[model samples]
Target: MERKKFLRNIVLVSLAPAVWLAACKDTGKPAAQAGEQATYTCPMHPQIVQHKPGTCPICGMDLVPFDKNNKDHSLTLDNSQIALANITTMTIGAGDLAGFKQLNGRLATDPEKTTVISSRVPGRVEALYVKETGVSIKKGQALYRIYSEQLASLQQEYLLAVAQVRQFPDDARFAQIEKGARQKLSLYDQSDTDIQRLVQSQKVDPYVTYPAPQGGVVAELSVTEGQYVTEGGAIMRLEGYHQLWVEADLYPAEAVKPGQTVKVIVAGWEQEPQQMTVQFINPALQSGSQLMQLRGTIPNPENRWQPGQQANILLPVKSKNDVLTLPVDAVIRDGKGTHVWIEKSKGKFEPRIVATGMENYDAVEITDGLSAGDKVVVTGAYLLYSEYILKKGADPLAAAAGHQH
Candidate 1:
């Protein structure tokens, strides 16, 4: 009993010293840890500081946290902020979108094929055969009637010389006068028929009919019956509508080249669009709309195509294949690089740097840093980038802290 009591007392003394030592430790000073502040100046530019904000002073660029090692696109943004964005997805099997930039243009007649029929001498119009435009006139069809004093005077002089030549056939002076008079009548718009008629009848026709200069469409008629027209007046405008002109307007880069074939459609006409032979490319871009003109000629025998009719033209573009593609809006650019936010799975994003190529306005091809089947954040990508950027800290786990791929 005495030995047991002594052992028990020894155990109590040992336990008491330990308990007192623990009490002394509790009474001593706590450890010295770093303090937190409401705001801080950047080492590079001290003027920059914000409450709950991490951005620089000199550049207004975001400040990176002292430590951030996680890789991925999964991030959380403020609940109150919303972003409007466009989203599209694409396959990575080496192809591009088969499409083009649409442009508007009109149908017209080929200027080179257009011909203006004019009066050879000043005259008062007597009648018009093909008065309105689009009237089909055969070659040599009588187009108009004209009364010209200039022409009548020359014919009377020719008749006087012919009478004198008959009266004095042996005289050289009469022969010379008759030859000069015949030349003058020929110059006064006397065709072979008119000369033959004058020789047979011995009478000159004062009023004359001028036939169509050429066989074609009556594109325009500038003279009216009983209207006085001056010399060299445009009596009619003619073009053989046997061919047509289709004009396509494109911007500088978008303009079809001189040799490129363009497909055109005329809506009202039921027949399929005839391929027009492209003949002219406008060297100057149109000032008002900044467009270039592409012209092609097609046949229009039925006069179905009128001037200034709108037409839709299709110009196939050079195609590319075997490329990784994505919607145009998915990219977020920064000094770091061109990057995209990829979703490894739900609530996770991996920020990836990409090498990009051959971008149309709507889509782009990714050349590197992406695999064929990687799911990317097409929508809400910019927001995720902002969140991941603003959420950095010594622990970096602050914003997207709970997300897991």
Candidate 2:
């Protein structure tokens, strides 16, 4: 009996630890579950947060698990999200803002390079060598053929005068008459070569062919085949593409004047920018517009560029040196005002409202809310702004305003 009693005591003592271990595990489960409690938030409408997985009532987007403890205005993105958003940062410091004022402009035909071709005599068009507009013509190229009774009579008179001059070489009266006839033919658009050909062929050809006086691209064809043209009437219009005019609009406040050299970047060929001098700035505003006209000339020696092409002019503005500046895209502007996303820590970003001064095409002046050596989100700032709104259910600028207050 004594041995049995001792064995029972040992068994009870051993069982006591097992019973306590079981109770401890049972009580710890609920506490662990409470610590692990998760909340869900809509990516698009973070205001719709719930303790369970469901769709957002406002935006109807699927709710995603979010850290409820993240109450600050700053946002944190993982490596994958950062890479997916293409977020990039740059350290800003005091430096010269080497920026350009971009002005929209277009290429145009230089009026000084345009020419109008006209007929020297009334005639009936027999044929056209260049039949259509936009045809390229070279010097001495046959332009058209014309048939006229007047031309035929002039050729006959020229032939008679040449024959008389050959027969009566000593007679001054015949020589004078020959010279007058030759001059008349010359006045009627007859070249020396045409007169020599007529004298050689000894034929009264009623149809005469005319040659182009210069090389150009035919811009307009006023006369067609079988169309009669009168003396001094327009036959065709030609334009030289050796140079083009670049015209842009400038506001009254822009400090641009004639003789200023500016950079011109042709659309689709931005790699090769040309330097052009500002030739004219209209003293008065354009009709029905508040902007003034800015004109410049660009050389197109290869004729590769066409008129009416979109172009951009880069005008240099007075740069502010030793100033805080950031990429133009780094700043965000909305109804909440202007702010920039700054790196508070690795993978963490916060919005800061900043006062701006002068700005240019590539950079903006940061007058307040930032200091030198601050890392700024230069790319994908809008993505961060969006993510902040998605995760925080508020505008990043709103937080900035709150801090300011």
Candidate 3:
């Protein structure tokens, strides 16, 4: 019993020291260490950073904490982190708003507005009133003069027939000759003006003048002074300068309805862009491209908007009553789906899957995945994703490599 008591005393003594050492190991070191300062940097310019958080001077952007766990975080020799970074952000919120299906394309002409100029009678041109394309013309304005042997002979026969008709008032030969002469002259564009003038003057007049039917700019000028033009031959192409079209290529699922109002951003123009609507949509997709054509009609009063000009089209879709939207660069696209990083606080970000809808170059519609008040890591989403990849034992390269959703 004394030996057992002695062994118990020894064990108690040993446990007392161990208990004290274990308590000592848990001193406030960890809690004090956890209060370390966080490092922050701008997403747009990674070179920018500060211990005291602030914005970038080059561009106004809020600084976010640099986290190693971010899937977008990458090692670099500059002692600086390289990762997916953006300076832009927006909120997905509930409100009355217009949704859009955006597309990029070039300015084009409205086929309906283009007018082809042709002649009714075949002849060789003697003189061209308009010398070059782009010249404005007016209705009833003389565009050119043509001399045709057929017209000259027809005029001579009409003059003779008119004189013969007047010489015998009741003779059937006179009436028949006059009727044939009038029909021949009419076929050559001898209008009532020309026919009446010939009858009154009792003279044969040859060379004919053709007038423009409508006023517009001469888009194409095929006639030199002496070009022989057949009847119905193309003489010039005239297009109204007051209105035009903007055409954009669209994917199969893009919503584009005729008469739907759309906003247009004209590239390389300083003037305020015009608002218009869809004029038409090609039923068949373009061969080899598999892209459908969407068109919008815009007024060209100042001639500022020309056909073939490059443009970014913002087509209004449905009105997303109350939802969240963010800058397109704010979300990181993963193989499974699109994800965003929600900033919990300093040095903490959580990965979140987001449901997306209509996405334009400027912003994205957050359909079912986000709320109006949730602050997300729009600038450093890729950085946060890096952490998720690490925890899942997944390849960061695979995530970083892009796949369009």
Candidate 4:
């Protein structure tokens, strides 16, 4: 009996560890079940899921608590994420909607303001005052010097006529001869000051310096030094920038009459918009194009604008009162269709397919799928779209479509 009692104590001592371990497991069973009910997923890699909070196996990011039972096509971001993404929202409301057709335009020199400087006499170019093509010249400024044998002969005739007139003071024929010589010099582009100086010096100048007819930017230089040119030969072309032409192509459907007012915005200088008047509209379509030419004039008193720069032309098409409108950035267009993000609740956004109407550079008209007082994601909507795809592993539009069906 003593040996049997000793054997039983040894058995009890060996079984004590196993029994304690079993009780501890039983106590943890409830906790394990609770952990199994609450799921955790990686924010960046939604495929990585676990029953308890821990680091994600795939991305090594901290896992966040996820509600498996909550099934909805929406995204919820924390305040920190929202702030980091620069998300902004606006409430929809009814207001006056002004629709404008934005047409691509370009700044061009007005033909009416352009002038061609030509040589009035046949002579060799002695020297050019303005050598470069883009030089700005003022009116009455010396342009070029021309050495001409005909001008020298005409000056000699004038000098002889003046001597004859002074010697025979009563002779009318010499006086008439002097008057004819003066008229001939004037026709050859000789200025009154130059003629007066020539008469005072009593010497004929073979090289006569001509002055600019008007102030403008030289667009072309046709003659070089020592280049002989005939009468009416182009010396240079100048363009005046006091007013610039805004030329834009318009579809036939866009009916804009001449004398109508339009808004012109230069690409680099958008802050200063000019209210220009439509000067002309082509009666026929542009060559090799279906678009018609729309032209307007904008004053550039400072000469700050240049030709060939890009511009945006706004033509007022229609205006309506009490129409729903939203910013152009708020709408998203994709393969699924056009949609927008609407804030269903605080920090929650859902995709909504909407129909849009007239649109301009900055705003669009919301025709359907929304109503007044609905909060919309005006900015940073694309960021939310990417976040939804990352967390949901699918496009929000696809889920929206499925719900619609």
Candidate 5:
């Protein structure tokens, strides 16, 4: 019986160790279950991990299933790295925004201030007092001389009429003849002084001098010394430089109102930008180009503005009172499409494809891919884009970046 007890005790010793090992294994089951209880993490801030689904504490981004397969759109940067990259962000919201439309234009002479010098009667150009274009002349200055047989015949008729009037002063027929002769000379652009002189001297002059009608610089001279010209034929073009016009083309979508002030920047002129008031806008569409014409006048009393110089015109486009806007710097452009970097959480950003509309110098209209109160990376968007490219070796927004149209 004692031998049987010893064998039984050895068996009990073996069974006790097995029971203790089983107890130790059972104690580890809860820890293993806890470790595998559906882990979650931030897609943007991958360092944020949790045992269950919840919002990230640092960025308020929703925690997604921790899957190693989908890491392309997600990026995580430490505090030090973010500081070194100089990253910044802004919360977009609905507000009043102003848009602008930029256009190209050219400086030109004011048409109202231009004068066309033409011949009043058919004659050959005898002599030109103004030699070339750009010659400045004053009002009443002799511009050219014309020698005409018609002028000479009128002069001789006046001389004979004056003789008849002096010989038969009491006859009304002689007075009528003298009046007819004076009328013929006046029709040929003969000045009153010249006519009176001819009557006093009883002489006939073949050539008559034409005086400049206005004071300005010659812009175009088409006549030579011996050219024959007809009545109303343009001889030259004179334009005043004290005032100028800035003209530009407008598309059908653009709206312009008279008296609205716009700013103009001359390409090569270093002076401060000039404010030009809207002088005129064509009511009908331009026939050939189908574009509308816009005009603005600028004072140039100093003769500083030159015609045909390039200019940049800025037209203020009206904006809605309440609309979400993103800074222009926040947007990214690639062959794929227009996009922006959205801060899903602090120190985390993801590429978001967006549709855009009207734009201005500083901001752009956000039509899609975001909502009000969404955080956007405005300042360091380019840096984030570069980081995404380097990390993924491909564009994060390639699939959705292509032109949607």
Candidate 6:
């Protein structure tokens, strides 16, 4: 029994050290060494974090240290990552955002410059010099010959009156009658030389040739040879190719008043773009299209600007100088609103919701939410947006507080 008690005492002595150590053990978190307390997170995936350095599970990129100094909702990039993304920045300042606005349009014949050739007297078309449309004719050139019984009867009257005046030289009534008949023939497009010839020959010509009043290309032919026509009947349609009208439809957002300058670029034309003023602006919007119509006149001395061809028009609807502006790529628009990315510090960026006004092809106006000298992302902004969406798994502007000015 004494020997058994000795073994029990020895076992108790071994247990005493373990019991003491247990009593002194710490029940809190593990203590970190000096300078080893930094937390790490994925640069492209901000939600992923680790107590020690590691790689990101989603993108397999090396984990980066968290900048506790940076506020939430700000993205931080290193020099290497910035170079890889080709990120660039610009300082905001005052400038003109209204250079010009581009639009698509088409060229058409100017109605004011179009002319219609018509018969002055009732007659049958004896012969048509212009056989088809598109025939170019010069001013005073013969276009057609017409047979008019009325004109022939007037010629016969003038010839007979002239003979009576010669027979009775002292008769004032006969001389007055001859003068009246001569005036009647001259009123039917008959020149003094044509009347003199008729009086000399004493014969009635059955047909008379009519000349083109203006130089232009024939756009339409209404009457054929042997066709009978009445007074003031349309013979042919002529259009002066020296000028053309470029017509474009303007939306309500791009409406402009008259006298605004427009630059026109004609398709397949080697000449430089021509500039013209807005000639017409419709007061009411079109029914189906909801677009307002406007037009400009373009000179076509060489006939290079053809009707029915496509044209691109740039209208300077409005312009303002000394206004805050930014590159068009800097602004991002979504359902939340328009916003831009601004660099708060070196390699650190934050989204700023902005109110925008006029915008052109290259730049946009920043009406609110920013001041002069603010650095903004001009290039590679979309890449940053993608990173933000991937990291947060949501739109950057989804939160109402994030969009608050």
Best by lDDT: 2
Comparing candidate 2 with candidate 6, which one achieves the higher lDDT? 2
Stretch of 10 with least lDDT, candidate 3: 73-82
lDDT (CA) per prediction: 0.68, 0.88, 0.71, 0.87, 0.82, 0.83
Report the error of model 1 at residue 294, Å: 1.9
Best by TM-score: 4
Q: List ranges where model 3 is wrong by over 4 Å.
A: 1-95, 268-279, 318-405
Candidate 2 wrong stretches, greater than 4 Å = 1-89, 98-107, 134-141, 247-257, 262-275, 281-294, 300-318, 341-353, 384-405
lDDT of 5 by residue, 187-297 (tens): 988879988888777778888788988989999998999999987889999999788899999886787788998888888663577898988888889888879889998
Q: Kindly list the per-residue Cα lDDT of model 1 for residues 43-113, writing each as its tens digit.
A: 33433455455657576665544223344335533324423423223334556654444456677776776
lDDT of 3 at 34: 60
Candidate 2 weakest ten by summed lDDT: 41-50
Q: Using TM-score as the measure, name the better of candidate 1 and candidate 2.
A: 2
Give me the displacement of residue 189 in model 5, in angstroms.
2.3
In the range 131-240, model 6's lDDT, one tens digit per residue, is 99988889999999999999989888988999999999999999999999988887788998898788788889968898998888999999999999997899999898
Once all C-alphas are superposed, what RMSD does model 4 give against the true structure? 6.7
RMSD of 6: 11.1
Candidate 1 TM-score versus the reference: 0.50
lDDT tens string, model 2, 48-111?
7778888988878888786666668788888899999999999989988766889999999998
Give, for candidate 4, the lowest lDDT window spanning 10 residues: 389-398
lDDT of 6: 0.83
- Give the worst 10-residue stretch by lDDT in candidate 1: 393-402
Q: Give the runs in model 1 whose Cα sits over 4 Å from its true position.
A: 1-102, 167-173, 217-219, 268-273, 320-405
Candidate 4 lDDT at 267 equals 88
